[model samples]
Target: MFERGTPGADRIDALRGWVGDGGGLLMVGGYLSFTGFEGKAAYRNTALHEVLPVELLPEDDRVELPAGGRASAVGTGHPALGGVTGEWPPLLGYNRVRPRPGAEVLATLGGDPLVAVAGYGAGRSAVFTSDCSPHWAPAAFCEQWDGYARVFGGLVEWLSQ
Candidate 1:
């Protein structure tokens, strides 16, 4: 990721190669992820874009839901859903994204891709398009929910495989 919009080709290729060689890539969402605030996070059209299971919007994709939005599990039978079962606590917000073809939509929030996973070459890549911490992931979702660990643990487990 570039601080000044410069995703150097070398870094992009290196990351692409790493993922292609079976490395697991996990992208967690936040103000600085997937075209964040004021279009600053900017992961729209890079090598990261190529491998991510979700497509990043060219503009800022933050959707604030102070009323909160709950995740709806959609990837039943997928390894990413392993032991993660039960209702999910409400998330404060998330980065809007679309699941690419062949990518499994593991979960959704506000009718958008909240968690998505895909295979790229010999590797795997997954994304949780919401903050793993604060603001978006609130205390209700992170601390008071058992499924929180189950969900993330499942994603990690699936990615590692």
Candidate 2:
């Protein structure tokens, strides 16, 4: 959502201030999130990077899955994944990220984090390191997976709480 110059900087500062003041924030991955397709989603160079529960890669971090990929809820039984269990529907791909120390790793894809969360001041933040739609997420994930709503809904509810 950040553009150029002062406006983008303002948005970054505002988001930090808002989250620190008890607002909820969520970051979904894509060609414009974290380190995008060609490094266009350069949040690694922004202040928003610190508020996330995962460390952003300094370069393009997209993990392509031309043959598709799947994710699994971690063993922690986090409320954000309340009823989600077993293997997840196939995903076209996801962004690669490392979980920050003390942050909760709710789900994983291969050896990388698929979902992570952290407390930011009085508020909270979460990251879903994959797309919610086409390209990265296929219909099986966005339209057919029964846990989609529950997982995302639970995240929103958790952050809002």
Candidate 3:
């Protein structure tokens, strides 16, 4: 996952190669992800951007929702959303991203891509446009949300396939 800090060119190239050769990649969002705080993540110009399913905006894209935002599965049947049903706990915030052509939006929050997946050569990649824990996810989402395991586990399962 390419989060807060930018990886060196060599590392970025290697990661691109690995994904092209069937390695799975998952990018998680946070204050330090995709154009992070003040655009610190800086992945838009990196090789990692090539494999992502979303286009990173140039500026800081964090959106804070103190009252929380609703997250819902997009389609009727996406494996990544297996077992994940009903109203999800409100999220504190997420990074804004635009889905790329051929990418599948598995979930959304306020019409924004919350979870998305795409194929990268022989491998698969996914993006979770929100934190998996804390501030964004909130304690309820981490500890009490019944679909947590299904949501995350299904993502790994889909990527591995």
Candidate 4:
């Protein structure tokens, strides 16, 4: 289960139901992801928080990262990162995340966990700090790095597995 464009209590409830019903979710980051800027995500009541391996702090100036400036080591042991090899191209930006207890920290940025994975009942979830597009990750949009495809595709496969 994936939801985009809106974040609120209704959507959060919907996501919770989906996960509880055995559906996997990949909540992409954006103005609508998690508790977006200005607390627009407040209505969501953080319901999906339980399903995530990380906690989203109130969006502050902290979310900003220079475009194409840094890269983190991929989790080679994890299937979601298997095909993504080599020095990663820079990612323009990513969401700021606080890891939850008992969560698997897969990748990090400057001492912060950038990617995380967690299991919830019969399903699971993965949190990618950056937007899954060229704008936020120009390398992904240009295909200059095969990492984007492998990371996202591998995630879908892992969720199903």
Candidate 5:
């Protein structure tokens, strides 16, 4: 799992190598993520995107779901979602993603994919279109959702396998 503030290419290669070598990756989205707003990340061409199950299209709009905004439905029965009980907290923001062929949809918002999974070599990858911040993923960061820890833990566990 990686976070915002990770330096560019160095990190990209590290992550790319990890996935290519059969290690799991959990890429949580943010302003520093895939083609982030205003093309801030365009230079590095995020390595995770190459193997991501969905294609992250550049958009001018910035999504910001206010704290305590609304809860989106989880993909019932999903290994990462299972045992995650209660309403989800508003995710402050996310990068919009376009699902690619063979991608598995684990969750969505307004028909937009919120979470996706993909396989790369002997490893695999999981993506959360939103940041792992209280201001970004309000529910998950604030622990308002009972399944917060479980979901994250489950994702790591599953991806590792």
Candidate 6:
């Protein structure tokens, strides 16, 4: 997670270099991830952007779905969505992102990309555009969603492959 601007140029370069050398990277979203709460994350202009599957918006990209939004697998055979089925728990919010060329969108929320995957050099990378813990994901998604482990575990397994 490239949360706030703690990573300097050196750290960003090191991370990119490491991932280019076959490291698997998984970026989890949060108030400090992606464009962040009010577009403060600012990852788009950094070296870490090289591995992201979506183009980060220049301004605040958060969408508050107070009524909640439904997310579902885009494709049935995607390994990252393996064993994930049924209606997902409603999400309270998420980052708005556009999938990059050659990137595969594995899941979506209200028609927007929710989970995306792509290849960067010799490694693989994935992005989950919603917070993994609170505010966006909601407590129900964290504790009661039956497919939670299956979805995330599949993402990790896919990256290892």
Highest lDDT against the true fold, candidate: 3
Model 1 lDDT per residue over 1-161, tens place? 45688655578668889999998888999999998998898888677888899999989899998998889888766778666766788898899998999998988888999889999999999999999887899998888888888788888898899
lDDT of 6 by residue, 16-60 (tens): 888788887888777778777777888887888878888888888
Candidates in order have lDDT scores of 0.87, 0.87, 0.88, 0.69, 0.70, 0.84
How well does candidate 3 score on lDDT at residue 119? 95
Q: Candidate 6 has what TM-score?
A: 0.90
Question: What is the lDDT, from 0 to 100, of the residue 73 in candidate 5?
Answer: 48
Candidate 2 yields a Cα-based lDDT of 0.87
Q: Go through the candidates in order and give the C-alpha RMSD of each one to the true structure.
A: 2.7, 2.3, 3.7, 4.6, 4.9, 3.4
Worst 10 residues of 1 by lDDT: 1-10
Order the candidate numbers by lDDT, best to worst: 3, 1, 2, 6, 5, 4
Tell me the lDDT of candidate 4.
0.69
Model 4: per-residue lDDT, tens digit, 15-133?
A: 87887677787766655666666767542356787788787776541366664546565566887564665566766666667888987777776566666777888878877766777
Candidate 5 on 1-161: residue-level lDDT in tens? 35586745577677788898898887777776766767676623566677777887765324666643443645666676545655666666777778888878787754667778878877888887777666577645556666677778778887978
What value does the lDDT take at residue 62 in candidate 6?
83
RMSD of 3: 3.7
Quick one: ranking by TM-score, best first?
Answer: 2, 3, 1, 6, 4, 5
Cα lDDT tens digits, model 3, 44-95, are 8799999999999999989888899989887538887766778888889999
